[model samples]
Target: MFTRIASALLVAGLLATSAPAAHAQTTAAKKAAATKAAAAKTAAAKKAAATKAAAAKAAAAKTAAANAAAAKAAAATPVAPKPAPVPLTESLASAGIKDALNKGIVKAVQFASEPDGFNMNDDIHIPFPEDAILMKTTLSKFPGMNTLISTFETQLNRAAEAAAPKAKDIFLNALANISITDAISLVTSGSTDAATQFLRKNTEAQLITAFRPDISAAIDQVGAGKAYAKMTSQYNRIPLMTPVQTDLTAYTTQKAVDGLFILLANEESKIRKNPAARTTDILKQVFGR
Candidate 1:
């Protein structure tokens, strides 16, 4: 009976020790499972964050590429140049006046410089001096006096025609020296011959002074002086006739200058009124308006 009781005590001790060991193993297994599950969840979250970051980076790259492409295209496009500004009205008017007047002067000079320019054209015909008209009338009654008067008048016209070309340079010089302070006013003036009138008012005295020598030379070349001397000699021989002393050079110069101005005025009128007369680009630009 004592052996049986000791055996039962030993078995009971053995079972009690095994039961505690089993309980400890079960708790260890549960802790390992929870740790594994937590690690997997963290890994999954990290993977999802990595994927989202990659997508965002890719989208940003795409947006940047698109912006770069747009910028490159903009750089490749050609831009148009800006147009030139229009000239001022006053400047245009002034230039137009100068060009028109120059052209008109050239035309007038060319026409008057031609043969029979003054004699054929009654507008510019040179006759015997007005101051000596009574001398002509008194001499006309004498035999061969009519022939002398006619010859003298023809020679006077020849002198003027010969002298016409020399006046062109003087005129051009005067034109070059002229100051057009009121160019706009002159252009807007309603008169067709306004430019010519202006030129005459400014340059007439200069023209006469410069042209008298040329007129005297032309008169001598064309035998106008000798013809005048002959006419005067006959007239001076008349009894009780008032002695007439007229400056042939001065008279012829004045008449010649007057003729040139008349022609110049006509040319200016044509330019102002006729569209076809605006031959140059500047002329068309100004007067075409």
Candidate 2:
């Protein structure tokens, strides 16, 4: 009976110790499972966040691409052409003529009034008078006569240059008095210097008449008169040579007037053809088309 009781006690002690060990093992397994589940959950959360971020980045890239395409399409589109201007009117044409004439006169005076203006310009340089060609030809044979002839020609040009400024007032006065009856015809005439031509036709006689006194004064002032007298005196001294009598003042005045008209015509032609020469709004309005 004591052996049986001891055996039971030993068996019960072994069972009790084994029960505690089993309980401990079960608790350890539960804790390990919980930790594993928590790790899986955290990993899933990180994966989900990464997928969402990737989707957002793709959407942004798509939007940027769409915007770029739209911008490119807009840039490739063609723009509409501008409308044509209205037909020119009579009043505008008249205004244009006045403006062009005024501008021409201004430019003419500026070009011809300066020192060496007429002397240097090949187109307008006043050579010795046509009637005095015999005198010039005969004088060329004499010693030192070439220098005198050249000096006299230069003096004539100098006189014209001195008298050029006086023409501006005369030109403006003529411009003011003239009527543009056929202004549209004049403007659309296709002639480059039509306005200048019209002005010359109407005003040339009066201009010459008004301009002679200034030319005569300028001739005396520039020593052209004394030069002419000296030339004539020298030529007259030659034996058996027909006396070369030429009107110096009349020749110089007419030549000066001719040069001024030529310059004015050129200026008018420039305004008609070259857009850059149209300095005023009225000029541009008339001629820019």
Candidate 3:
């Protein structure tokens, strides 16, 4: 019986020791499984982060490329040049008219103030009185009467030449008095001699009044009155011919004024037609085209 009890105790002790060892082994296996699961989770997270970073980098690169392409396209496109500023009609008109008038008057004055200005120009050459045709017809029949007539004609031309220099101040004064609206009208008018016509219309009476004194002085200086008297006396001596009287000052002054206007008109027309005649910046701005 003692031997049997000892065997039982030994077997029980062995079983208890085996049960504890099995429990410890089970705990170690559970801990190793948990560690493996944690390692898999960490690997998955790292892979996901790498994928997101690569996608973000690729997207950023794509955006940069698109921007570069857009920039290149902009560089390749051609840009239009800016247009020139246009001038105002009113400004153009004033400038053009002033320039044209200045040009015309200057040229007219130059021609008229020179030697044979009125005497040589056929267009303006002062002829003997139209009313004195009968006197001329009767006088030419006589011998020395023709010479005296020629002398009278020459003196008439001489008086005109002497008086032409005074025209510049008169013309400038008329220009100064011109209204802005009037200047614009003259420039915009299609007529080539519009400015000249304006001057003729406005300045004729004034010029006639102003020029008479100078013309009268010129007539005396050139002895035009005495020459005209001699011719009239010779004609009056003929019994069959009616006696003739001429207003030498009046005739010469009228002819000179007419001649000045004719020359001015011609010069104005040239300025309108010829680009070379546009001497000023304002002239070119309005009429250059």
TM-score of every candidate: 0.67, 0.72, 0.68
Tell me the spans in candidate 1 whose CA falls farther than 4 Å from its real position. Answer: 1-88, 178-180
* Cα deviation of 203, candidate 3, in Å: 0.9
Indicate the residue-level lDDT of 120 in model 2: 98
- Say which candidate scores most in lDDT: 2
Any idea what lDDT model 2 has? 0.88
Candidate 1's residue-wise lDDT over 1-289, tens digit each?
A: 9999999999999999999899999999999999999999999999999999999999999999999999999989987786554453777778888888887788888887788888889899898799899998988888988987887788888888877787777677666644556677767789988888888988889889878998899889988799889888878888999878999999999998999999998987887888898888787776665
Off by over 4 Å in 3: 1-85
Comparing 1 with 3 on lDDT, the higher-scoring candidate is: 1
Q: Pick by TM-score: which candidate is best?
A: 2
Q: lDDT of each model, Cα atoms only?
A: 0.84, 0.88, 0.84
Ranking by TM-score: 2, 3, 1
Poorest 10 consecutive residues by lDDT, candidate 3: 82-91
